[model samples]
Target: MQSVALLLIGIQLVYAGKHSLQYFYTATSGLPNLPQFVSVGIVDGQPFTYYDSKIRRMTPRQDWMAKSVGEDYWERNTQASIGSEQAFINNINVVKDRFNQTGGVHTYQEMYGCEWDDETEEINGFDEDGFDGGDFTTLDYKEKRYISPVPQGLATAEKWNRDGSLQQRKNYLGTICVEWLKKYLEYGKSSLQKKVSPQVSVLQKDPSSPVTCHATGFYPSGVTITWMKNGREHHEDVEVGELLPNEDGTFQKTSSITVTPDEWKKNEYSCVVEHQGKSVTEDEIRSNKGDSVPIGIIVGALGAVVLLIIIVVAGYKVYQKKKGFKPVNGSDDGSNSSAHTVPQA
Candidate 1:
């Protein structure tokens, strides 16, 4: 299981030779202070466009995206997102009816994407739907069919299969999607392909608390953090966290291990981070107090740095505004669709 976990992380993070384009759509019911519908476009793991029911507009999230397109593009995508908003709103209720629920917080989500391997020139596509955090249906691009894990999704699968949607999906994923992905890569090559190394630190709260190894501000979002004991891989009492995005499009992650102070005094323990063909280690944290900083102080310093970055970004945006820069926007086309039918009672 550990090896499998590492392999999956590698696949998600090691994108030096591969690229992907993905879009996520989400709708909810009975939730307050949140948009009823939201759509996001990501190219190679970085968000480039976004829309929400509250804003009712499609907006670019990156500078390249804004500069590469015109106002017409934003208008078209906004219209498309408005249509998707209604469809997804209806979809949430339809899914709720399938589950035999009348009210409460419920969610419906769709994720679709294509992957390109530069070295092999291989292309792959995926589409999936979920309800209340569980898999509802998925598209088998290879078989050109839909698979439903629960009975509730059978009707949707059947309808999609009979409606000539499979061929449409196949063609889009195989050709149109790939074409757009390539265009995006070319347009944003400098920002998308650049690499940034992480700043690693070992932190401890107190004598009895677990030790945490943190890596932040790394690009490409692919990193592995492991604990080593006596020069061997250590796994006991270890907790690995999910990858989280930073404000500047980089990523951060933490992995912690629990060990007694006595054990630390006796054995050699180190934190190893592997990213982008480079390895970083803080082997002296266990034995040297000078190297292992207190968690509270480190967090405070990080908070200050984050505030500084935010200020700098705000000033830069103001500068762009003074220079008469504007935001830009995507149309849904058939590429973005619900592609699901509600099950009948």
Candidate 2:
């Protein structure tokens, strides 16, 4: 019940009034301190969705998306397209059709968002930042929050909106974003394996001290920084920090604990960091924060039952040897034992 309530709260957050959804896919070739790939849809300040390159599909549309974009748009572009291989590829072309060739650190992003405007009927607006051979460009609707002057020497530039641009009519926009997302998912995490290890440090103010285990400049956001005492995770006096974005697009975090000088001298404390996998295929998963304990217990129980079945089947089997025969007229093999002689009242 608590989880369900929290889920409702979370869903309401993005759809409450109005919010923005920023879709991003990035790939890098040379940055040592950045994530190799990033495919995410950030709604307001939280993660609303992401692309799954492994399966070549966008995530399930939140309720907000259905209400905002209309159900048909959500199903056709995000669900149906990714469900079929050819349709998925066609969707990828939507991004490729607009993006420049990839090299070095390439980033592709789209801004399709909604807001509660009592004065304005809800209309989806889109903006995109794309990489070029040696430069970058922005394409967006006129109503977007950020609008820039077109390049000095561009032959043509196009900006489309549902009602604003006048030249291009926004049609099946959700479908277009899906394909653009596919393009981003293709290369965004190309540098995942090339991540730079965080610079970890334990700091204390005095000899007997509260120490801060600081980890900075690590790529791929879900890195876990843990403080261990004598090789075991310690939580009583430990503080694990959150991921802070570096100016360079990499990430940083810190975990802290307090200990006596004697404990410090004995080296009883250490910091361990677990870096997550990078690829989307065969490696991507949804992080369910509240259900871990119950799910683990359920899976463990099921495993024990399966192990019991294996134990029984692995035992030896006996052969009948043709010596087996039905006793003539139901006679026993000299071993008929009776514990009762009729039921005497």
lDDT score, residue 61, model 2?
32
Best by TM-score: 1
Angstrom error of the Cα, residue 107, model 2: value is 29
Which residue pairs of candidate 1 clash?
none
Q: Using Cα atoms with residue i matched to residue i, what is each candidate's TM-score against the true structure? A: 0.78, 0.31
Candidate 2: regions farther than 4 A off: 1-180, 187-194, 262-267, 276-345
lDDT tens digits, residue span 1-345, model 2: 111111111111222223232333333334456433334444333343444334344453333332333334333334422333232233233434344433354332222322222234344444333332222223344443233343521322333222243222132232332233222223232432234445544455555546665656554433555565665657877776644556554556677676666555565554555453222211121222121111111112221101110000000011110000000010122121100010000
Worst 10 residues of 1 by lDDT: 311-320
lDDT by residue for model 1 (1-345), tens: 121121112124334577877666677788787777777666777777777888898888899988877776777677777777777788778778888978888777766667888789988877667777677777787888988889887887787777766666676667766777787787788998777767777777776788888878877666777777876778999999866677788878899989887787777776666566233333312322343322221112211111111100001111101110011122233233212222221
